[model samples]
Target: MRCLKMLVIAAVLMFGLTSCGVTNHMISNYNVSQTQLVLSKDNFRVIGDVEGRARATYVFGIGGLSRKAVRENAIADMYRNARLTGAQAVNNITTTVKVRSYPFVMEYEFIASGQIIEFTGE
Candidate 1:
């Protein structure tokens, strides 16, 4: 009986701590400027930094919508924001979304940057 009670407590604790929102650190690492372009020299290109973020209906625990919908919304927002900000090009994009604690759901941040590469043919 004691062992059963202990197991139940552990399960509850685990459930309480589990999250499915997102984090800023993960979003900061994604690249979205590729689609966004700016006028550079004579040609238009994506430049500058790209970032992403998610807005959850619930701070934690995937309360409002389906996981797929939430993810799509977040990515769309990032793209929209990045494009609006005037980026030349975004590359090497990554994201991480997860819930933090209970009743404190949060969305991770997105980040991306554009790099100019030069080729010299002599």
Candidate 2:
């Protein structure tokens, strides 16, 4: 009976932790600014590339920022890091979400990336 009970406990623990390894990936595009401009063929040049990442965790479905807030925070972080000048802008923005699911917790990582460009002419 002792061996049988130990076997049952081990099985239950294994089953419980199985959800810890689950992960999901998602990608989407968003507009960070209201003023949209069409990049001219020869008016702007790529200055560099930038990326911003943010993480939020929730346990038992309660904690941290909401999904929408996390995404916005990631984009805002990217802009804060860029420190764009008067004639500089960020383009080709993409946001990636990494979700790690556990039995009682969820971890989210939001990554925002884009290329910085500077206009050579008006």
Q: Highest TM-score, which number?
A: 2
- Estimate the overall C-alpha local distance difference test score of candidate 2: 0.81
Error of 2 at 66 (Å): 1.0
Name the candidate that leads on lDDT: 2
Error of 2 at 55 (Å): 1.8
Tell me the whole-model lDDT of each prediction, alpha carbons only: 0.49, 0.81
**TM, every model:** 0.40, 0.80
* Residue 12 in candidate 1, Cα distance off native in Å: 15
Summarize candidate 1's per-residue lDDT along 49-103 as a digit string, tens digits: 5555554455545466665566556566655666543223344455555444444
